[model samples]
Target: MIDKSNQQSFQRLRLNLRQLEVFVATARGGSTRAAADRIARSQSAASTSLADLEAALGVELFDRIGRRLLLNESGRALLPKAQALIDQAADVQALFTDEYAAPLRVAASFTIGEYLLPSLVAQWTQLHPKSQIQLRIGNTSEVVAAVAGLDVDVGFIEGAQTHSDLVTRPWLADEMVIVAAPTHPLAGRLATAGQLADATWVLREHGSGTRQIADEWLLKHLGQVRVGFELGSTEAIKRVVAASDGLGCLSRHAVTQSVADGHLVELQTRLPKATRKLAIVLHREKRLGHATRDFLAHCSGVKQ
Candidate 1:
């Protein structure tokens, strides 16, 4: 255990608030000019602040390779610590500012963000109205990465991940159902693994968690299907499936309305159910704030 005096000494060695702020901004924005614009500081001032921070720490934070500013080894090593310090500082500021200070920053994948999280967030806000909530929606991989990198306090993702830096807890179960338009030739037919291999498939983009699961399942059962198109959004995939002869694998939640409205028909297949474990992920070393903790508890079905 670190002694309290040693902890204080280490804190003393940390960059001051202004320098830390500038460092974090530059690291996130990928350039001094972008950081300056974000923080309302001049570009020269941002650059000077970063230089002063590196000089004080005796390490170089960024390497100027061509036009881009990339984080060096030292920068990568210090980034999480710097971010933690900033989060702690924000907590300190919040402590003195009445009851609540700012919105909780959350990142979530497309399906969860679009189909599931609205009710949960609404309930959370009703209980803690003073606590604001900001959400960033992305694909599953992006959401997982955002939480692991401390870019957001928490993330809701659609599938299991093995990232060592993150602590993942099962939050929900999502089913991936294979579906096609009612007018498609395969609409009423039961598909065998061999039959599915011959049909054209509309797939999600590369980094989407749904896409990863779909691909893995396909590889395990059908080896490789004939892909007709790759789409980025779930809605777009649904539209393409409705208009084309291609079949699609999508979250059951995503196409519930379409299925009910007779636009799409779920195909019964010989393959096993493609159920995915949706997870709530957080940085392993980060402490959760009140609002963040509250949200997690709600998702976990634990009453505060």
Candidate 2:
């Protein structure tokens, strides 16, 4: 004999997707604010959902010490089950609703994430009002890895290269430009090879598409430049470049506002137009489900 009493205790239990989502986010974030940001939910809503989950489970999923919430033993045990349920439920819902109910998991590199995907996601939401979009933003390599790891349904990357295991299709055209603070010396005139090579450059960290492109295009034109800093964030690089004499190479889209605001200046260069095609990639091993296919078709239509 088994313990029927334990099973009977949950006879009246009702657990919704929102609660599971909140729980999983809370666990992954280790803080309510990060979790709320991740899921795009209001802090109050996140907190309430977490509280509701704890109440329903009759156990505290997290231990509150000071303002921080740490997952306790019970939470550790429940996290995997909650994640599995969420993933399985999303798939099942897609099957039943012909993909309308399917949740979308999208990953994008920094340039696309900051400049493009938000608008695209807004447009996507307009068409499928009930669609749930979960987006992850990272560097190009990270986006490719996410696709390979099956962490995302689709990935957008601006790298000149992609993983062999992914199907790649060019999505958009992007131009990389060199930028500096308004007061920098090279901002107003064409930069000499020596000046370009001698200047301090704040560039993206290795494994980033922007950095790879710069390495391939800019570095060859101007001999090795002095690396002032290596940062993982494009926004941070922009801010740093705008605040100092350090020059940075970034997508033109990223520096548009800064240049217009007189905070950053787009530098003139003699090098061939450093343009690259932004690409959408899908894992070779995964067949496109209806939700994925629909999103792909939408991208194609929108681009066309």
Please name the candidate that would achieve the greatest lDDT relative to the true structure: 2
Cα deviation of 121, candidate 1, in Å: 1.3
- Candidate 1 matches the true fold with a TM-score of 0.66
Q: Compared with the true structure, what per-residue lDDT tens digits does model 2 show for residues 97-182?
A: 74566678999999888887787788988998878889999998899989999999999998955468899888888889999998
Worst 10 residues of 2 by lDDT: 93-102
Off by over 4 Å in 1: 1-101, 302-304
Pick the TM-score winner.
Answer: 2
Alpha-carbon runs more than 4 Å astray in model 2: 1-95
Task: Give the per-residue Cα lDDT of candidate 2 at 298.
Answer: 84
* lDDT (tens digit, per residue) of candidate 1 on 1-304: 8799989899888568789889889889999999999899999999999998999998888999876789999889988988899899888897548444467889999888887787788887777776677889999889988988899999998866788999888777778999999988777888888889999999898889989999988889998878889988888999999988899999887889889999899998889988988888989999987657767888677321
RMSD of 1: 14.3
lDDT of 2: 0.87
TM-score of each: 0.66, 0.68
The positional error of residue 266 in candidate 2, measured at the CA in angstroms, is 0.6
Q: List the global CA lDDT of all models.
A: 0.86, 0.87
